[model samples]
Target chain A: MTRFRRPSAPSRLPLPPLAAQAAGFALTRLLRRIARRKPAILSRLGPHGGARFLIDLRDSPLLLLMEPGARRITAHPRRAVPRHDAAIRGRLPAFLAMLHGVEDGDALFFSGELEIAGDTSAVLALRNALDDAELDLTEELAAIPGRPFDGWLRRASGFAARQSGLALSRQEAMR
Target chain B: MMELVCPAGTPAALRAAVDAGAHAVYCGFADETNARNFPGLNFSRPELAEGIAYAAARGVRVLVAINTFPRAGDQAIWHRAVADAHAAGAHAVILADLGLIAHAAEAHPGLRLHLSVQAAAANPDAINLYAEAFGIRRVVLPRVLTVDEIAATNREIEVETEVFVFGGLCVMAEGRCSLSSWATGLSPNMNGVCSPASHVAYAEVGGHNEARLGGLLIHRTPKGAPVPYPTLCKGCFTAPATPSGPAQTGHLFEDPVSLDATELIPKLQKAGVTALKIEGRQRSRAYVAQVVRAFRAAVEAADAGAPMPAGLLAKLTEGQAATTGAYAKTWR
Candidate 1:
């Protein structure tokens, strides 16, 4: 199939400004959880052992800087080299969904929901690295709560989605 | 009764299809033998056996698709796939290559064979040849036939016929197209993947987002707008115009709309189609379940002479666009 030109859709409801704080809170939990869980999932993503990345979550003022393959992950890291190895741009919920394996990156790219700019190979390596881990977002998120996390996650994500009018930013909170 | 055959990319999707009322669930091993050679998809040998048993318990059958063509030097892989599917108790095996079909028919004479759509058996002669030589019991007809042509061919061929009722559509004649290989050096025939992800690149230029397949521009969409997977035939390109001022640049062949013949189910059944196929093995379990449930209702309504559900699968279609492709005589 080809040429699925989307009729001009009203832009997805932008993440509410107030929700950005909550998104940051959720994102920190997700990153820390993933770091602890997969440990080295992004270790091989950097090329030449110095690939730096900037993740831009649309509709939010937050910017994340990462040095892939390095043990330490710095949020909004300072870059002596003006250019990052790559920049991945998308809404926070989309990235969380992609990280959780609930959403397809190919589909998101096709639908113009996600964008990658800069070193294509680095992005590809990152995708492969994360995919190889086969991390379960649901199960990992459950590590936050004691039991019955699935139901709690669903309800939280739903509540977050309703308040923020965001896709899955709230559920990603538990991450 | 017309059979509603569905696809399952994962074991979960397979179970979902069976639970949603598929007459037969078609899947493949997680390798190059299947058309959808996506990573993190498909079943292992043990998983296939489990899937078959699950379907059997529900009185639903499972068909194994090993439809990609065998490489000249290594036909053993394809042969092994057929033997394994048989050993796993698949109700039938869907095949495409001539030699492979011959080998299966000769080695296991009792096994039921269905000619894959990749064979592109469009006419009566090809169908008859496959039936007589390989003992193929069914042929998945290509998407190029009109309803009238299908009825006419059914009158001439002895084997049962199946047509795609929902899911993706290919404008080119199946099994014979080289557009993908021309650009990407991989095709459904040899690599079992068309428009592989490795070669796909999406870039933003100016204000529009462009999708490229093997570095060739497939289509460009407005910033923040939806773009389709860069399948070569479905891309937007400029074609030289006849004595016109400027070349035409647009979806030159077919738009990125999926095939949805739910409205035409009764007509296709009347045309003597023995089975209806849904053409996505790389979809999610939710997608598989929804499409199967809707199509099951449609097929049942057609069989019982009841009014079919209207717009039952509109949201599930590609970009919310669907068509009754090549089914009407007017299309030809």
Candidate 2:
């Protein structure tokens, strides 16, 4: 294991530059891992379906994840509606009535609150896959120390420091 | 001189605004088609027609705001609102939402269309895009630009520009915030209400009053210390501690400050704003009359190259603080 000199200040001290970089790198890696698993979730939803959604972000980022392939859709901050297409753009009450069947996760990826740009079908499919997956990155990230990146880097660098014989600094130790 | 477009939630408010020297008065029908869907607010069909006649008698114009997005599969309601406004002799109808604007353009060719701030078309390109596509005569700017940005926008867009000069302020881009819907499942764009009263609940716990919206505690304040309505973006929250220090407590999004642009009337006129809008369609007629009268005096002073009148509506404020809000870069 790496070790390093400890910094003096505990509360008010800033993280060393190396620690920050390590944290950022770990975050990117984790994000990539999630992205890689996205296809696995999509495959379960079949291949060509679409769901419209609205995500309300009161407690968390309101998402409208949809999986058109698997004919699955879900939402959060539940209102009413299963799907709203361009054809039903003006009947809000009816759309809301349909929203009642939706779950919180379904709204997160496919809701009207999110404006979907190009590849609408693909986005809808991606949303479904995301909703069905047992991923809880938001919760996991929340529990981590510092901003998500800082937490990852601090832990990674701390491990590296222990193997190196350098004394772990106070700043690194607290992180 | 620039036209003064004032809000009139009620028939009495409309008459009072016209009497107080508003060049034009904007109002909405008493229904879900309008943003201020509060009970006992807005005008009836006959009242709208009468208000229009009254404004016409005084050489003032009346614009109807049918600004809410039509619900999906139910376009008739919004279509009727546009048709009714035209039938009632409104000078124009303010609108947002692409689908609704397209429908109005096709259905009511003769009626003028002014883009509402809900469009959030801040840049010149977006403004021009709407003007070119829908023949929008005027665009009510979102409260996100500085005077310099407004001036630049005026130079680029062919349509007239209207800016809010006083009253309620929104920190985020209007129609783009999901904070309300996230908590209460109602949105300003879709439901025409933000931090709606139906979803808000207040409780006194210990010596503090806690403001809860959709069952989430948003603000806790000392009793009788003037608890601001818990608008999600303007509430105080705790940010977790960072490596740099412990957690910080304060408004993470924005402060509870209303926009009072009276002092910037001349600068806005110089920036080529065609009209000045005063928000508050849910206000009392007395509030409407007082604000309109003060703004009229200020506009007249601006036209004459004189200083604005001082401290006009000190008593009208909710918490005794006002901001120019993003009109100056200092807001950022």
Candidate 3:
């Protein structure tokens, strides 16, 4: 069991330098676990006119390449400028929150937080796959062996609730 | 008594809305024909037929939404939806696109027609045109008008006006906003999904958590701080650096809040509004039941000239923030 001090200051960089590589490996393992539980999700990917999804984690070394129907989708960190059908660019937490159901995808997209490009049909197909499967990402992550990442999830949730400014805003509105 | 038209994403939600005192519950087929097109939501032909029967037996009404624009090449799917809605004995077929309305009016003349809010027909001229051309009975007014504007439009148009009194608020002009498509590559007009669920990904980076839609960063929060669902309009973004200024990021269009017009029930009555619509068909049956029961009491009290209840649904709203939307003549 490994323990670390609480992060007193948030990193200004997009992702922590050391955590990116480990996170990518962890994410790949986690995703494989999820796909195993729900193979039907991956099935929504292959037939979308040969679309490959590029997930770009800015400020991090993890450039996840997802090839629809091709074996071993996340060809982890290969070479320069991956040839792909579509790419989703963001930090690590954004991806985690979505897969974990801590946030809503449509809501994020509407907010201009998530950007999608390339063939939309491919993105739509991916969306359909996950929707059909309905896996609880947070729960699955918590159940992952060799790590207790549940603490981070719980802390993240508590952070969202506080930042929401529920009482302050509503009270101001009433006034 | 003023009629309350509630939303029903599923048959169970339909029953819950009706039982909680909705005069009419609106639903749609499981396709791109309606706005609330999500997975595992909506009814099939047999299910819709059964829902209609269930509502009719209890002195309630069922409205079918064939509201989304019918694709140019494959209009038959939507046509089949309209025909099936009429066959299922729906009280009215809610429509948005002019061509589909024309098709419904020409083919199913006897079926009642209600103009959907997706049309964004804000003024009297547009409402009158829809009423005259398609014989539309009611128009679900968009959330872009003040109550006074609604009353003014009501005086000019012949059709009954239904206004959304509660639920989520859309800041963009309905049916016109393409921000979702710009970001997600999926158009709500064509796919019936805005910021679709499949493309969303969230993760924690550094000591903060970030949310993304499609792939663009919309929101970031200090780790363990509340981050809202990135509904492009409501998501926080850094505005492009302006002249003599640096980039400022915030919820530029609107906040991650819901619309709750519970207080304006009496004022809307004076505006000659025909029906009060609650916008959340995609919500659960329990949510439908709770909102309907509360609104039912509020409407009933208003009819009797009693004091309106205070903050009856303060807790149900997302982020516990509610606004009157355009009814109060304010920005979202």
Top model by TM-score, which number? 1
lDDT of 3 by residue, A78-120 (tens): 2456787777754455444444333344434433345555555
Comparing 2 with 3 on TM-score, the higher-scoring candidate is 3
lDDT of 3 by residue, B1-332 (tens): 68999988767678777888999999998789888776556777988999999999999999999888988899999999999999999999999999999999999999999999899899999999999988999999999888899989989989999999888888778888898889987666777777775566666689776778888887787754545556798888787788989988788888878899888889999999989999877555545777898989989998998877878765456545788888997774
Chain A TM-scores, per candidate, are 0.58, 0.29, 0.58
TM-scores of the candidates in the order shown: 0.78, 0.64, 0.67
Superposed model 1: Cα runs more than 4 Å off: A1-56, A59-89, A92-111, A115-139, A144-175, B240-244, B329-332
In candidate 3, how many Å is residue B249 off?
A: 1.8
Evaluated at residue B157, the lDDT of candidate 3 is 87
Sort every candidate by lDDT, greatest first.
Answer: 1, 3, 2
- Residue B5 of model 1 has an lDDT of 94
lDDT of 1 by residue, B52-103 (tens): 9999999999999999999888999999999999999999999999999999
lDDT of 2 by residue, B224-256 (tens): 455666688878898899999999888876676
Q: What iRMS does model 2 reach?
A: 21.6
Query: Given the true complex, what DockQ would model 1 score?
Result: 0.17
Q: For all the predictions, what are the DockQ values?
A: 0.17, 0.01, 0.04
On DockQ, the leading prediction is 1
lDDT of 1 at A3: 23
